[model samples]
Target: MKIKVNQESCIGCGACAAIAEDLFELNDDGLSQAKVAEVPEEKKEQATEAMEGCPTGAIVSE
Candidate 1:
């Protein structure tokens, strides 16, 4: 599946990046952004958790 971070809603809490390091990262602006074009097969579950763990619900599946 594909994912993207909603920049407007992100709080730069680093939760998504911390929960799923392979799939998300904190950008230079300190907000989370998807690191890959798609969530890799092995990392899908972790990606989901990261999305769910986002306090502001900024991570979106596309």
Candidate 2:
């Protein structure tokens, strides 16, 4: 799975990073960004959780 953060919609709440540190992080702009273009099999569940946990619905799976 591919994960993406919509910068325009992101609020930088850090919930995604908290839920999936290996998959997401706060960038210099303080918005959450996907650490990898594609989610590793081992990290898919956590990534999905992070996506769902995002308050602004900025995280998305492609």
**Residue 57 displacement (Å), model 1:** 0.5
Every model's TM-score: 0.95, 0.96
Task: Choose the strongest candidate by TM-score.
Answer: 2
**Tens-digit per-residue lDDT, 1-62, candidate 1:** 99999999999999988898888889899988899988889999998999899999999997
Residue-level lDDT of model 2, residues 1-62, one tens digit each, is 99899999999999999998988889999999998999989988998889888999998898
**Shift of residue 38 alpha carbon in model 1, Å:** 0.5
User: How well does candidate 2 match the true structure, expressed as C-alpha RMSD?
Assistant: 0.6
Worst 10 residues of 1 by lDDT: 16-25
For model 1 the TM-score comes to 0.95
Which is the leading candidate under lDDT? 1
Clashes of 2: 0
Q: In the order shown, what is each candidate's alpha-carbon RMSD?
A: 0.6, 0.6
Number of clashes recorded per candidate: 0, 0
